[model samples]
Target: MPQATALYTAKTKRCEARKKKRRMTEPTQTESPDTTPLILDVDGTLLRTDMLYESLWAAAGRNIAATLKTCVTQWRAPNLLKHALCEIAAPNVALLPLRPAVLDLADAARQAGRAVHLASGSDQALVEAVAQRLDLPGPHFGSDATRNLTEQSKAQMLVERFGEGGFDYVGNSNADLPVWSKARRIIAVSPGGTLRHRLEAMGKPLEVVEDRSDPFALLREMRPHQWIKNLLLFLPLLVAHEFGLSVFLAALMAAAAFSIGASAIYILNDLLDLESDRLHPEKRNRPIASGALQIRNAMIASAGLVVLALTSAWLVGPPVAALTLLYMLTSLTYSFWLKKRRWIDLASLAFMFLLRVLTGAVAAQIAVPGVVMAFVFVVFFTLACVKRMTALARDVDHGKLPGRGYGADDFRALKVLAAAGIVLSAAAFLLYAFSGHSGGLYGSQMIFAATVLPLTLWLFRVVRLSELGREDYDPIQFVTHDRIGLMIMVIGVALVILSL
Candidate 1:
């Protein structure tokens, strides 16, 4: 019996050894080397598309303002603009903008032989487009392949793709912390607040890339040169022969007040559009959109600004106050409502420009000349058309305008509007030169005409450039800093002042 048992045991040991050898000889599916991957978020981390929102807002402002005069509820404004822009310029529209730094980092990682993956909550298509642009190879782990990658969904994706030994993550927000914690190495991008401090306490390795500053961003949002219409508000004072220093000072005050109020409106607009802006390519990093400034904080700042605006208006008296209210109403309507309407939207925008001139006149206690009023309307309409035409051109160049709702058809419309603007603009300049007022404003009739020729040519050139998508500028910055335009403008202004 003992001999039989020993024999069986020996045979079992031999069989086990043979099986082990066979397993070792054959290739198995199990991996030996572990992989550490880098996961990045889409909205705040990889790319920003806030500019798309601003552009859409601008388009909406042109289209929506013609309807109701009283404030439109917030709910209506959001959907109205979203639907309108999507319908008008869908080709250039996209979910979000891509960040160059994020791509740079991904490239750096690839060069360093680090595995790269995107763990985002954005739509797979949008993120993939961004990844492709960045040359990222991914079995992506994030939200629905089609929707946005966000919050808890992003963390789960990391686990689903790599399980335990699959990745080390890099990200910029608390939303990423869940996956970051699971990561072998956590490379934090633009870390801050509780998450930053918590990660530090946990002794995680963190890397920070500061956001870039864009000075022209705000001016782009507000379309500042449009403020030139504010100068019209002073026309009444000029006609009243109240062009004295006091009236001039009052007019200046109103302009300043309107600007401040307008800026405050911009902040609010950014806040309301924050989510949509996050998906924009250029606008995502806006001071308001990038999470650098909290919405609560932004609201507080806006309130403070409004208080200052009201104080300035009050100091200027009832006429100034009333005009300020009108300005605020117009701007707010643009920000919230009229921006969603179509041609009516454009009409309202033109009216707002005309009103700015009227306000200046009222604040200064004067009656604006009929020619000046006509000129303001014509010039403003032409410029508005130019602005729309530029946007349409951008949509064409980009192939599509997403989220904002514009399409190729809209681009065609913008082209037509721009052409109309050119014709009307030429007409306005001619009218300005030939009108009887040329003698009073320019000194010599011929002097005004000469200035008009240059001014008209300059305007045409700018419109053409804008239509060609050459001037991808915030209107204010373009008008104020474009040396060529500024120099020509100076000559035109000098001619006008000399004539006066």
Candidate 2:
């Protein structure tokens, strides 16, 4: 079976842009008769995503053992591997982002008594399923047990079925150039970069249907705003009062490495949450969930980001690299299994934050205080509960929580847990006021201790907003847009400077 290497992969498929009105470049004035079949490519033509990658992720996320077993047994045959994966975890056709332009075109053709066909490099079973989903009446073709049908092979199939220059084709990539060469008419739907010009180079009259995808979608998918959480990596340096260039650079390195690595994990989480995210009120709008980004492209980006993170961490020294790897492994574990378990998910989230602080200390060669670790654990645990509370509260407002395993009866326990966590975190913050580490490092320990008042008030406000369902899923991002959060942050920073 075709399989993903990672544990439970995430999928963020965008549908909005794929269905938008297209900007036509040139209309195809076809000379072909009504008897001619209108052929469509499944991946990136009828759908916004590639079925191969989608099913692979689906299998890895939902049916890992079956998929892995198939992979080990059928690794020699590409077609068999693909068919095996589909049997294990075929994507929900109803949930896939079917391109409206292509669907509309197919409908118009059908209304005119013309035949419509599905031809793709995806496995034959999947192609037939897609044709069945459309209820189209005509032939459908895909790669079989012995051969992968693509490029020249696809061109050959069309030639044998309809003769060279007898069929009309809709395609979106350079790989389709060979197929287009034999078609009487060509239609391009949201063609990849430079594909239009290349199609034009073929000297064939082209009908272009453009879907204006966000040019910066990949960056948005990386979620740069959430990188602010990595700023916590500097906590050890600040608390240690180590302003030296080497240590400062070390802290920055650790933070950057963590930021990139965390993004990879977030992408994984997004993929695994695809179906659930589609049901969510707010999460459905995310670039990945909304089909604003392609699944294969997201996977490629995630893999690249993982490499960048690990290489960067290695540059930060062995200890930092080890810690970064630990964080990533824990995050993947959380995504794959721990998240499905009660309380364990929240504890893992909190522990991840502690790992960040610990990595910072290791990178900067700082001797971390015990209270600092305690403060991180309780405070982040409180925030984790706050996140859950915010989600549950929204469920109360919306009547259902899409992906959460929690229900109405669990709400009271969640509140109690959050409340207890808040009280404990507050107690920890108070202890920070009297921490011997602070007094020894800061010039004005009293000023440093005074910062606690605003910090405590900030935490309280965060919890209150969560209770009201006014906070975003991510507290850090919510704080970025919150005036009170900014004010408290400014005051806290000023107080820290005075202490320094």
Candidate 3:
């Protein structure tokens, strides 16, 4: 009996020694005055953008077909989708838009002898890369093939690691609600109105980090100023001398429809070009590239705009609707495929502008002379080339233009081609004026012919400005904003009106 007791005592002592060893190795609640670690939510908290979406954009940019295939294959496995996207994307950590305030807070916490951890729903590899790039001190926890570490899962992990109410959480979205409830302190970074309301309801002490987002961020994303380009839809109505109320209304509706569709395409382009835009000098300020707008919200807005555009197109007429559909399909093709093809991209832009005129003609039920259409095509093509040349000048030092499949050597060729296009445009305009079409439409052929002089001067000025590297990348934008271009436009319009 004594031997058995001795054995039991020996087993008890062994267990006690093991417990003591664990106590020595594990961190204690009182290890330091700042025992609670700062747990950062990577997406929208530590970083201004979501890494998962950023990775998806990069993957799509690399090979859209492969990215789509991977997404389909892993539709039911989000963690695997994230991993696959990360592998394909291989994002540059230094280029990501990080929130300075959140980063400063994390650094301060670390300096205060508190642990700092990055907890995110992003793939493990992506999280590790960002943490390492920022030189973060603590370990990172991220989603893997089996689990997506977010919301409740993130809260559960923190509770398991540090115990409930033992850590501080920094997050931005409503999804962080559960984690915030579990955290001892809530640090809100750019919390929206709904999140602010919820935090107030919780009656918990909170630290607010201002987002510094532009107040007109959504409008900027929609690019309302770019809608001015859709005025091309009115050219046919004006040139055909159809000023009746019905024709005017149809043209207006067509313009609105095109604007809506163009805005949708712009949003999609921004999403696809996020990585490339981040590398660009000026384009990096775009709302999506700068992380001022969320990807999911942008996607929703784009879808909504497309629906509105289609509905408005249908209201105009069947032919107008068909033309609008064609424009959308062509634009989609350009965004997805042709935009990456050097010369083809310029041709596609010119074609889209011509389609706007065609749409206007259909909406107004007016005939546009074939020669006039040819002039429009050539002029728009020259302008498109000029835009490309300006972009090439800016990006030549990089050897290759971002998002565009053009090399530095192509600049001289593009300039030569643009000059040829300008000559062709002038010839087309002269042919239209002398071919008797203008005499049939206008009271005086000489007056109509005189309009070409201002047009030539305007085109020359545009080309010279572009060559001097003093033009906007968008030629239409430059024409709309430049004082000399606007003056020339007004004079040309006045001459055309006199001829009519």
lDDT of each: 0.63, 0.83, 0.86
Worst 10-residue lDDT window, candidate 2? 5-14
Residue by residue across 138-230, what tens digits does model 2's lDDT show?
A: 689998887877899999999999999888899888888999999988999877668878888888778998876677878887888989888
lDDT of 3 by residue, 1-500 (tens): 99999999999999999999999999888543776899999988888788878888788878888999999998788888899987787667788898999989988998898888999999988888888988886679999977999889999999999899999999988999999998899999878888899987887789999877776767899899888888988888766677899998999999999999999989989988887889888889999889888887788999999889999999998788888888988988888889999889989999999999999888988889998888888888888878877887766474888788887788788888888887888788878777765667888778888888898888888877787788987665777789989999999989888887
* Residue 37 of model 3, lDDT score: 91
Model 1 residue 466 CA deviation (Å) reads 8.0
| Clashing residue pairs, backbone N/CA/C < 3 A, model 3 | none
Predictions ranked by TM-score, top down? 3, 2, 1
Following a full C-alpha superposition, what root-mean-square deviation does model 1 have from the true structure?
Answer: 11.6
- For candidate 1, give the lDDT of residue 53: 46
Between candidates 2 and 3, which one is better according to TM-score? 3
Task: Kindly provide the TM-score of model 3 when superposed on the true structure, using C-alpha atoms.
Answer: 0.89
**Model 1 whole-model lDDT (C-alpha atoms):** 0.63
